[model samples]
Target: MKHEKRWAIVSLASIPLVMTLGNSMLIPVLPTIEKKLNISSFQVSMIITLYSIVAIILIPIAGYLSDRIGRKKVIIPSLLIAGMGGIVSGWAAWKMDNPYILILIGRVLQGVGAAGAAPVVMPLVGDMFKSEKEVSKELGVIETSNTFGKVLSPILGSLLAGLVWFLPFFAIPIFCAISILLMLFLVKSPKMKKPVPFKKFFKTIKKIFKKNAKWLIAIFIIGCILMFVLFGVLFYLSTMLEDEHKIEGVKKGLILAIPLASLCIASFVTGKKIEENKVLMKWLTFIGILLSAGSVFAISFTENIYFLISIFFICGMGIGVALPCLDALITEGIEKEERGTITSIYSSMRFIGVASGPPLFVLLMKASHQVMYYTVTGICILAAIIALVGIKPKEIK
Candidate 1:
């Protein structure tokens, strides 16, 4: 890559890093918030869910706008809105006697901003690169940045919440500001063709879907399943560490980071290795999800914390390898004019997974630990089947 493109990647990478931190950092803090506000587990889980739910509704619209306008035009303003949402949450947490509802509203605003920011990165990366290999490699970098944010979130979140329970909320704006500055100074938006009329755009999108519906829908479903399992497991682990093991604060956070670190490393490595190979992308995705399913199934038989942590690390690696493959498949397969919309729809599906995970996990855990593990394992198996059966590499382009 050229130096300019490298810098642009850096700027583009920051969006997912900041966006992930804004959301995932709050996972470790949920227990703290639960205690502080005297709320139930379900209510605290809503903090994550509400942000994702709002994002799900608005992401397609953002994608469409980015396609018609420009990626940077959509992203910078979204960052501002996300930062403002952080301020609202932080102020309510710091000042209000009853901050729960206000905090949720703030999350809603952040979701609206997120709809435009991170999901746009994949398509923007596609826009920036002409080579299929370059697109695959950079998408890996973007995915790695996302997972790195996950790895860092628990530790950073714990450290911040240790200082003040609401400190993490305040940190969102600072993160967003850094991303915005980087984007403004470093990233150049690719020149786009004349904007198509809405009717023509719609027809084009429908045609693309009709031609590629099988693998496209399969990838969308797989993305949703992976996120659903990832967030659900994180929620389960966070609560388990605190409530059952008597672990809290940074120690708990470090423990939480172990699995995510595995994920981060695997994503970086996978991204580097799988350059433009659609067949490899399909197999890696299938094998990765199978690995996750096996690990999750093993969890049903063990309660030892070490064993559990080790299993999660394996599961993370499984998820790590698969994610960039999914990213590359979608980004590489789509035409530039429609890439934003297609990838955004894929993103919205992932957010559905994010939105559903914790609350759904809470209900499953209530039934039994075996039930929870078994259920996720079953879902993972289904996703693997979808990858193997639906994604025909020869058909992609």
Candidate 2:
């Protein structure tokens, strides 16, 4: 990559890193918030859920706008909005006697902003690079940035919250502000052709979907499953560490980072290795899901913290290996004109997984730990089957 493109990639990569920190950083802090607000576990999970649900509803709209306008046009204002949302949540948490409802509202605003920011980066990366090889590599960097944020989130969040319970809430805006500045100063949008009319754009998207439904749906499902399992496992681990093991604060956060660190390294390596190879992408995705499923399945038999952390670390590696492949496939396979919309829809499906994961895990775990593990493992198997059967790379063109 050229020097300018390298900086652009850095700018683009910040969106995911900041966005992941804004969200996942809150995971380790959830139990803290739960106790602070005197709320139920389910209600606390809703903080994550509500943010994602709002994003899920709005992401497609953001994608359509980005397709018609430009990526930066959508992204900058979204960052501003996200930062404002953070301020709202932080203020409410710090001052209000009854802050839960207000905090949820603020998360909804953050969700609105997130709808336009991070999801748009995939297509923007696709827009920025001409070479499929470069695109795959940069997308890997983006995924690595995302997972790295996850690795940092627990420790950072815990560290911040260690000072004050609501400190993590305030930290969101600082992260967003840094990303916005990076985007403004370092990134430039590629020139786009004449915008397609709404009716024609709709028809074109329909046609693309009709033609690529099998693989598209498979990718969509697999993306959703991966997030569902990832977030579900994180929540499980977060609560388990606090309730079962009497761990909290920075210690808990450090423990949480172990699995995510493996994920970060795997994503970085896989992103570099796949390099425009659709066959490799497909097989890696398949194998990654199996690895995740196998590790999750093992959780049913063990309660040892070391064993559990080790299992989650393996699971994180599996997810890390698979995510960039999914990203590259969707970004590379789609036509540039419609890539934003298609990839945004993919992001929305992943958000659906995020929205559902924690509460569903909470419910299932209430029934039985075996039931929760088995259910997630079963979903992973189904995703693997779909990837094997539905994604015919030879037929993508």
Candidate 3:
């Protein structure tokens, strides 16, 4: 039974790797898609934004359904839909040669499927692990898989794009397929000794929120701001590489992969430390925002590509250190029964930042490089203020 439970955690952890790969894997391929389709910068940016839009719309619904039906039931279908979407996008990229519409449609599908997989995985982890310590440890493993996918996807996606621009789209389906199999074979839903009544369940949810609404909202906003700052920088850097530096395809992939590598390393280290101390987590998050804000500032000061890349890497490390702690904080704050709904809300706020980041950053870039830094910097300051004011350490557990 113990082995079964551990295997279940490992299996569920794979869901994020499969779903997020479709999102991050496409980053390196973005420049290729632009060339293939001859789309404008705004249109190229739309592919990413559209994916987030779909997720933002669907995540709460998926989370609600997971609560109603069961996590496994919703998750399996979500993977299948996302995989089909990937295959369709690849075919469209190949046949129509109009990368824009095909990729957009594919991304929408990926988002819908991805919506169910990512938001639910955390709640599932909550349901499985009984102890705070165990939950923290598993959250670390889960967070690692999530960041690892981000790290590896760009490298692999870039390599695939080298062979064929459309390959990354098709490649995601294979991962989804594997995840589906593992989920079905190895993952099992825990038997609930007693289920909550609908009225009581709603009352319980309200009570939890009533107790911690302020902190919950603060953490959600902080996560959103962090995502906003992180992705905004990434979008700006990707464009700078292709437009200013004249880097494309595999070279673009290599440059982008540098910061993601930092993100992967930092996520693993921070997850452990955060489990031990919320005060430390709070300080680390503040520092992460500082590092990220500094990176955006650094980009404005330098025309040197190496320095620009270094700043982006520093920002990614800040995000990496901050993300798991955010997850751990939310998990620690909520009761087990409410985990699905609360995590869903948390995921939605993060997607809101993601969905908005690119277009907002791109728009700011038109004004000046300094504008981009200031915008992200302002967001970080807001997040920092919330952390300082709203998150009381004693209340986390």
Candidate 4:
């Protein structure tokens, strides 16, 4: 029980790793999915959107259920559902031969499972750690876990898809299984006496709406805008490499990884510093947004892969520095009980941004790649402005 805190952090952190891996692994293998399914590019885009749509719907419900039941109970089953979805998806990909439908099915189920676990995990972390400092550090670790998954996912997906079309689907179940094991062994939640009444729950929401609506709105919107900018740029970068530069296989993986690598390093460092100063956190985030915008803006001017990859690393680093702090600031401000609900709302906004980014950016690129990149650059700059001006930490009740 002494190292309960460390164990809890590890367990809570693993949940995001599983979730991120499942969501990102498809990026490298999107072309394979299109080839196998013989679907239009527009339809393939839905494979990603459908999952986000499901998470958007289910996240609030999951948060409410976790509050009523228990965090661990909800999380464990959610992992199982996600793992099972992976299995079904793999099987569907192999047996049905229509990879698109099967992938969508799997993504839908994964989304359902995602709703239950992803939003609740951070609140569980909040439950385990009392110190605002510890919460900030732990949230950094959790965000790192998410990026770590991104760092590994493309390589894993590329290797797996290289082996077989269905193999990438299997990676999800495996990650979920590992997450389930960690949650079972490591995460220990305090008991709750009774579920909050629906009437009271709504009243609390209304109260929060009236009081902290600005912060709540800002954080969620910021979360959404941040993800939109991050992923939209990623989508554009990947396509630029694949279609224009003609990079493929492991080389493509490494070039793509430059950004994620930068992000990983920034996340770890920012995590270390966040608790010491709120102003530092605010400035770090603001600077990160500036770096992100600058890097993308630079990438727009370059047709050279070398120039593009270098600027992308800077962009990635900025995003990396910004994300953990953003997560910490948002969840750290809320009470433990309300963390799940608020975090869910924040995550839903993030999913909305992420869901919109790929297709919308893809459309913009159809017109002009420069326009697409500039649009995302503007969004990141706006997000930076919002974080700098909108967020002012409050005393915890």
**Candidate 4: tens digits of C-alpha lDDT, residues 154-215:** 77777788789678778888888888888888778976657678898878878876787766
- Candidate 3 ranges beyond 4 A from true positions: 1-3, 97-99, 193-199
RMSD of 4: 1.6
TM-score of each: 0.99, 0.99, 0.95, 0.96
lDDT of 2: 0.94
**For each candidate, what is the lDDT?**
0.96, 0.94, 0.82, 0.80
Q: Candidate 1 — which pairs collide?
A: none
Give the least accurate 10-residue stretch of model 1, judged by summed lDDT: 295-304
- Candidate 4, residue 397: the lDDT equals 30
**Rank ordering of all candidates by TM-score, starting from the highest:** 1, 2, 4, 3
lDDT of 2 by residue, 1-397 (tens): 4898899998888999988888998999999999999999999999999999999999999998999899999999999999999999999999999999999999999999999999999999999988999899999999999999999999999999999999988998998999899999999899987998999999999999889999999999999999999999999999999999999999999999999999999999999999989999999999999999999999999989999999999999999999999999999999999999999999999999999999999999999999998999999999999989988888664
Residue 40 of candidate 3: its Cα lDDT? 73
lDDT of 3 by residue, 99-132 (tens): 5677788889999998988889988887887776
lDDT score for residue 304 of model 1 = 84
In TM-score terms, candidate 2 sits at 0.99
Write candidate 1's Cα lDDT for 282-386 as tens digits: 999999999999999998887789998999999999999999999999999999999999999999999999999999999999999999999999999999999
